[model samples]
Target: MDVEDDNSYETSTLQVLELKTGDSLRDAIGLLYEKNVFGAPIADVIDSATTSGNFLDPYIGFIDFATMVLWSLEIGELAKSFLWDPFFPVHLNDTLFHVLLLLSKHRIQFVPVIEQFSSKVIAFVTQNAVIQLLLQSSGLEWFDSIADKPLSEFRFENDEHAVHLYGDQSIAEAMHILWENRIGAVAVVRRETERLIGCVTRSDLHLLLDNDDIFNNRKSLTVEKFIHLEASKVHSDPTIEGDLGALLSAGILTLKNKFLPRMDSPVTNRRTDTLKQTMKNLAETNCSSSFIVDELQRLKGVVTLRDMIVQFAPPCMDSRINGGGFFDSALEQTGCHIEKGTLVSDH
Candidate 1:
């Protein structure tokens, strides 16, 4: 597409959630959860002393939902903490290329769009939004053409390895692993076989919001017990008391309970699979990454959306090296394929 000339695409108004400096972190997190967003722009608190009195004039930073969770756990009170600072925001006049560069360089999910002087957040752009636009406009065939490449080429060995959790591991341990690795999810493997059973994610931890006691006692309880209790409570059709009874009957109340049932089926792909197929799976499932497996179903590597973006960047750079002629060629290719009867002409 003619990204530069088509300013219309870049200037479209986008409605986004904005967080104030003084807003409670818990309330902000709740708003994110309710809206199913990962983060929001953090606007500066209004300064009453200022003569302009423009509330949107200063944006300090952005707060990620995951960061909020970590802070909440640390302070023991979400209300005590304020939004984190030093966030990156994109300018309204910036081209899509600039946004792509920002997303790829920072490895962030979304970036806020702000006006030049006002610093007011007009909208936000997400990796998903950009990918969707590319797919709809250019189709996936080009991406699919590159899919036959092995995933190993894209794997980052210097980054932390995939951390797995045992069913009997404590929730505190799981949280620590997540925090240390700075990852949102981890594989839950069978203790004896080391085989993947299920997966646990930050969202799964949302179950803790339902019970203050459980949230408080997270350290003592095993993941197995927590999963069972959550499942029984959420899935059971009986009364709340009956659900508690079921939880007790399932032998999950005691710390000695060793039952470790799977929570959610793991999303995985073999290392032998083509990148094209993997990308297709990721798009269709709307997952951030897929576990790379070996012939024996052993966990080997991980292919994340960031990795894919990194891989695709070089080719895009190559296309742009010709001083914007690639878009003209693409447009020519598209025009040549138009049907005879569909052509419009001035009579």
Candidate 2:
């Protein structure tokens, strides 16, 4: 494939959800939920002397919904809480190679693209978007070989140390577990059977933020309860608001409504499944990770996008480095520590 210089590329016109410095964490999260986004760029409201038009100061950093959840749990306040420092941003003129390096290094879903001088965010790039680009590019067949390998070979130490949550646990407790472990999602299993019941993700926590009743009563609510409540909303008939109202009024809405069917039946693969098959499943569903299970459907570990991408770094670097000088210089500009084409180490 022919490589193009960074200057020839244009910033994406996708409207980014920019957050102000004073935006409450709850409000920020609600916006994320409304938009179904993982994060947003944070800009400070500022004044410029040269122009009459208002301009936002350089973005401080990016705030992730997951980070917001952690902060809320930490301070025991959501509506009044605010995010502190955000993650680093990439320049708008940076090549795709540079953005990939930053994403891998930071283990984030997306990176904010800022103007070189003004540091103002112009757009953002996402891991899924980059992955799609690679899928359409030449030499994608290279993944065919890598995908044939067993997941066990790619499993890392942290994957072996999988953190879990019991269905009976409180939502507050579940949030703490996810925050403490710094993971995007956790497996929820039955207390007695240890059977995988459902999964709770950082995005799922947004349900609490969207509803005041649930958030205020979180202490008395179980993780299962939260999951079931969200699931009901997802499956409920929008035209029949009266049914939902009656259920809520009667206090009969319970876990029996079923967990969010999507989360309830987690996307999974066997430990022995080929990487190619796993990747295909993940891509088809647009999910970030899948539960690696044993023959009996018992959870063995988790396979995430970061893990798969890290495994592909060696080959990706070789492709880019050999593509020509333009690609080589772009990779070098990323300032990512590298040895023999592979990433130095996981972030």
Candidate 3:
């Protein structure tokens, strides 16, 4: 899709998902899950058609799971406090190549496409959405070059160590790590063996918030308890239980209950796993990240959506992109690099 082309990625302003300032937290959660979108632009007015005019703040900044999760920790309602991030905005006149550069090279998660002066948001180009485009390019010369290579072939920026926790760690502790690092999820392992058992994500945090007692007593609960509390929902609630078996098991999870992600194993990939393999597992399981492990499944490193998207990114012509060094002569084959697009500076 050419970003400069008016017809590409076009949708009426009416079709845009906009959360208002006055919506209840519960209502906001229900809408995000119901719409199945990563996030939505926020309008200051109750049913405002126009959002974030000439400024991306309070609109795209008030995004999905991360925005809401961070917001919940602060107060009873959404405020301007949690709206800051590294996201950059691209105008409709920007090239698709430009969007790709930000998604891949800059490792930016969301690039809002908006009108030039008004800053009226058109839509978001995200890493997940872009990666899906790359997947569809299977068998293409450029995509296959990297797709077929093992994950070990690429050097990740912080492949050094993945943030993780033992099952016994308090839920409050887990939330602290996620909030401070601004990461979505962390690997959960067994205390004695350090073997991967499950994970807790920002998305999962909402579950605890759903229950008044759970939310208030989070400091007292272990991560294991939090995960089990989530698993228990599958057993008791039929509404949210479609294909959740991949998320939790029907069998007991621990000495207390039966679950090890799926009563058998956690979702993971090996160093030898291909990029394509990990992408498939992520899409199939609806998981945000893949825990890399040894044959014994001891947690090693984590492959996040950001890591996966960067792998398929084309080499940038602009020397200014943070990681200027790209793979091989792939740069010659790819062109139309820009120094930078119109970015929304985080306030």
- TM-score of every candidate: 0.66, 0.70, 0.68
Q: Answer with 1 or 3, whichever has the higher lDDT.
A: 3
User: How well does model 1 score by local distance difference test?
Assistant: 0.57
Give the alpha carbon lDDT tens digit for every residue of 268-289 in model 2.
Answer: 8877787666765554444567
Best-first order by TM-score:
2, 3, 1
Report the candidate with higher TM-score, 1 versus 2.
Answer: 2
- Find the candidate with the highest TM-score and give its number: 2
Evaluated at residue 91, the lDDT of candidate 2 is 65
Error of 1 at 323 (Å): 18
Q: For model 1, how does the per-residue alpha-carbon lDDT over 1-347 read when each residue is reduced to its tens digit?
A: 32333322342334666888777877887887676555677776666776564545567777776667766775568565463645677775566666556666565665666767676766555554454444444335555444456665445432235678887787777777776787756776668866665666655555566578877888998776665564442322223322233232222111122222225545678766766666655544444566776766566656676555554442233332221223323434566322332322222
Error of 3 at 167 (Å): 0.3
lDDT of 2 at 82: 59
Query: After TM-score superposition, what is the CA distance of residue 343 in candidate 3 from its true location, in Å?
Result: 22
- Summarize candidate 3's per-residue lDDT along 1-347 as a digit string, tens digits: 56655332433345556677667666776676555444666666523465534343445344565557656764656554455345477887776567766777653456777766655666665444455455667888766777778878867655547888889998778888887777767878899998888787765655564587877887888887667665453333322332343222111111122222331234689989988878766644444577889898788888876787765455554555433223433433353333454222222
Clashes of each: 1, 2, 8
Candidate-wise lDDT, in order? 0.57, 0.60, 0.60
- The better-scoring model by TM-score among 1 and 3 is 3
